[model samples]
Target: MADIVGSMRVFVRVVETGSFTAVAKENDVTAAQISRAVTALEEQLHAALLHRTTRHLSLTEAGSRFYERAKAILADLDAATDEARNASVSPAGKLRLHCAPGLAQSTVAAALVGYQRDYPDVTVELKIEQSMPNLVEDGYDVSLISATQLPDSIYVAQALGSAWSVMVASPDYVKRNGMPLTYDDLATHTLLKLETPVSPPDEWHLQSTDDAHVLPLTHAPLQVNAPDVMRAMLLNGAGIGTLATYSAVEDLAAGTLVRVLPQYRVRPFTVFAVYPSRRYLEAKVRTLLDHLRATLTPALEAVGERVEAMTNTIGEAAGQAAKSA
Candidate 1:
């Protein structure tokens, strides 16, 4: 049998353009090919779909009825094809995003701001939860998580970046207790601890070139579950607290909080954009993932650079003081 859809398309084009040659040229097919397609369509339908003369071509009474139906079929097919293509490329509709709590206040929010500006059609519903959500069961398009390790699952985890824990104190606390030059120095300082369900409470893990140190905050003055609370406390000069780079970048940049022990850093936790594994990833999810990778990675790197610079400055001052003494 002749391709009914292809023939219908050609027949509709022939009727609309009113010239076989015009349809052929427009479709980049030979006029003979266009004529053959219409002939095949008419033979299959058992009716003449067009009346032809030397000067012009017109549709017969039966042709007019067939033309309307064929035109509608072609239009519907075009609309369906366009809808599929748009779904593949264009990011529209609602994207339900479940993100880690502290991330939204950091680069995640900034990345999303830029994402929204670029894709005005996409509606992003962001939920901040401490726990990771089941992407398939919860109907979340994406989940942003911070963890030392992600559990084995069917979900695909794309690393946005890593967030290293940095020990920071307010200028007031530093001025009062002086800067901690050694790991042991932290013992004398009032340590503000963060007690998260994901990590152990009242313990700061530090790593340097030669040794690994775990500072037990047995008598920590304040302990909080949320990073923002810990950051607020640190900003208020409550004590020295270890915080994720994402949570402390702004304060570190403004010199409100200074990084301590630049040479030693805690275990760097990774931030992942998690989504359900699929043969074809949705455009909205893919676009947001790309945006996060582009924006969040650089932001985290900048935080690292600023923290390194601060560490170097502190180290230089300590060196100069030793020489003078």
Candidate 2:
């Protein structure tokens, strides 16, 4: 009839302290109340768990065996409670993070650096792949995805920012081959294509102020699965290829690579930090999501601004050239 778990605690304390009086004093309860708790536990188990006298108390054979198991169980329960409480308050333990490979190097990696510095107890396991991983199956705490649509309705997504592909070529290649003035001009030039598991390999979806177009590159001379490889090839004047704005921000800023189409835009994809729809969000997961949004949103915005500035510069130059002609 007595609280079974509470009785166990009293029994363990009585055995540890060697006297009901001592545990009673420790818990600010009377010795008789402590004795009643042990009696209830013994009655529930139908086994005498202690050999008691006025001056001495000791565990019986059965009591000794039960004591060992009970102590272990209590210790494990205490540890589990502490772990859960700590995880809710402080960011600690291993957090598996899955991210798209193209954003891994610049945006995700940079945010993780600051996150680790802030939360030293949280160990981050970062996995970068081109394909989206199953978060619940793979045991990932969070995933950063760049896509037009969310993979499933089960995930809670926070939009980090927008991501888009941009057609880029080296300044030297533009000078020699002439810049593609329109989407139609892309057909006459050598095109470097990105082959990915998620998207069509030879097709690009482009948009303008008033219309959207899907351009299929049927004669791409070079194709690769890696974004870095595509960037390298474009830098070497291999051909015009589409690079994610985040991937090509540096090249565009340095004037090494120029945006090919100023008037047209690639279809933009939203970047989201997604996690399972759970009742409670752990501190580690929530903090990292916040860190990602704070860092990546600005980084993506900066890339957009830089690309826009470059586009305006190119447009102004073209207009001046027309006047001179």
Writing each residue's lDDT as its tens digit, candidate 1 over 46-137 gives 99888888779999999999989888888899998987678768998888999877777887888888998999999999998878877888
For each candidate in turn, give its C-alpha RMSD to the true structure in angstroms.
6.2, 3.2
User: Candidate 1: how many backbone clashes?
Assistant: 0
TM-score for each predicted model, relative to the true structure:
0.72, 0.86
**Cα lDDT of all candidates, in order?**
0.84, 0.86
Best by TM-score: 2
Model 1 CA lDDT for position 297? 86
Question: Which residue pairs collide, candidate 1?
Answer: none
| Cα deviation of 308, candidate 1, in Å | 0.9
Candidate 2 residue pairs that clash = none
Instruction: Please write out the lDDT profile of model 2 over residues 90-163, one tens digit for every residue.
Output: 89999999988788888788889999999999999999888878789989999887887775578888889986
